[model samples]
Target: MIKHHEPLETAGPTVGAGAPAAGTAEAAPQDESEHGTLQKLKVMQFNIWLGGSEVEGGRAGIADTVATVEPDVVMLSESSPERVTNLLADLAERGLTYFDNKNPDDRAVLSRYPIIEHTSFPSWSKAVFSFGGTEIAAYSGHLEYRYYVTYLPRGYGGGTPPPLETSEYGWKKIPTGPITDADLIMRLNEASGRTKVTQTVLADAAEERSAGRLTLLAGDFNEPSHQDWDHRTQDLFDHHGTNVTWSTTKAIEDAGFCDSYREINPDPVLTPGFTWPSDNPGADISKLTWAPDADERDRIDFVFYYPDERLRLHDSLLVGPSGSIVRSKRVQEPGKDRFWCPTWTWPTDHKVVLSTFHIATR
Candidate 1:
């Protein structure tokens, strides 16, 4: 049984979406003559539940998570001042550094390089993004990539975890409109639809003007892809980013962006391999909720790249190499919850995700 250092809070953003917020920083000049120019590197997204019933570090937990990813830049949501502030403080303590949101955890980013600009998109109500870093005229310092970290409202809330009902999953036929009833299913779908549109607008903007610079958006998108998020359940998000599960489950597939993990590891493997069932280490997951089914290990968290993608950001700090898992669990202070499973662990329920990269100009 893998022991955990308990702590949690809101179901925050996915891997890259909720690590740490980044702020403007001074750019460091590069030596063109020495190592020459470099190409743009990888971007990452994740959700750290924060301090809650499931996980419980609050801001302190977020701080420890930041160190784990070791990303060049990061975006996080559902995090608060205590969490963000504590993270910056922790970074400083560990010889690391970061910038924070003056207003709490609306959205933020942390980076290895200096941040040149940070702004929020109009589409995302509680979302913000960062597009700043050392930009050199040449390819080496070329900061041609921009990133967004977001968290949409959960389509289903206040209900006993939902049980899988059918096989349509992501394609659960959209209910006939004029939705006037207060049925839980209808209301949740409506909320999910709104979130879908919002994210689509944001993603479209990035994809529309991606001038050879890849635009990536990451988060615990309350709505999963038509295929993955739904599985045996109903597909609520029919219009998210580019293409969704339809492209995958259909006979004629239209995989919009490459699912990086699949590209690298062809044979799909249950991420986190073990330690998900809220009940047992590997219980009878068939009966759990679709949102977090123990057995169905789908990609709720992800890394997507536009056609403008450059050198891919190497993956694997989060799910370290075989026999070398880098724990994202944080050190606990006194007077905090101690349960480790089903709720209560460092930072948030979702694990802290990390991705690192350096500009490529060679």
Candidate 2:
């Protein structure tokens, strides 16, 4: 989802513990391992809204988010070649250095270490980088946003015109009624080409895994996860009493990748991680809501990693506003999930997903 241009919010200095001071580097942990040593690797999945141009002071906020998180790797969605250059410069000014694949697409992968190799596809980008002596194959994706069938169950059109009639058109509130047919929902959702894109990513990750490298995939899938749409949450979050095994995430799970956020917090009811329609004080409600009369908050962005003997998940947290736009209003999430609220301005329309892992170096 994208937001219209709004008056930019002024970014103030953000000083926090854990973040390294300017012109300095964070000291790496000295924990030793049987093979080599264990190094902390933090991965961040963020969709900087339209290259951080949608919200006021969003550009600075994007830089600040990365600086504050101090992630070892970041999979950025909705980013352009220019945005990558700007972000590299921004981070450098903060006394942090980062590396990118230099992909010319809307998605890019940034790493604290130099990228050893890289490749790009129609919908995603991949980079192979070494961290603490281990090679990591990371993929960043920003899938197609059209045919958003999740809105159909909420009584809004999924952007599929003609033949398919809906109670409401586009993101307007014309409550026709909910479409709870599981079959129809999956059919329309598959037409979005997200699954196809995911398949390509899975294939590439498989090759990387075969080579003994750790694999990670993260981005804005523009789709909900099957794990979150089970019976427990069928009636919550305006799901309209239908459960769907959304294809993209299901495919990833089927390929042996674990959703880091969900793995850390298994109970969907207690920790429903909604990433979209993030409550941005800098933007009007019009830009955040797709179905103004219904709860459209969803966990579309994610951080998934293939489990390996060399990799161990430590923690994962949502990073952004604690509140989200539900029924056209900024409502605080009622779940037990905790958010790492940015001391600086929150940059994007989607909440950032940060996952921490300990990778054994060889």
Q: For every model in order, what is the number of clashing pairs?
A: 55, 2
Q: How close is every model to the real structure, measured as TM-score?
A: 0.51, 0.91
Residues 38-134 of candidate 1 have per-residue lDDT tens digits of 3334344535444232332344444544454345545554545665666677667755666543333344444555444344443222222232422
| Number of the top-ranking candidate, with lDDT as the measure | 2
Assess candidate 2 and give its lDDT: 0.82
Candidate 2 RMSD to the correct structure? 5.3
Q: For residues 183-294, what per-residue lDDT tens digits would candidate 2 score against the true structure?
A: 9889878878899988998998999988989999999999999999989999988898989999999999999999999998898988888899899888889988878888
Best by TM-score: 2
Screening candidate 2 with a backbone cut-off below 3 angstroms (N, C-alpha, C), the clashing residue pairs are: 8-56, 9-56
- What's the residue-level lDDT of 59 in candidate 2? 89
lDDT of 1: 0.33
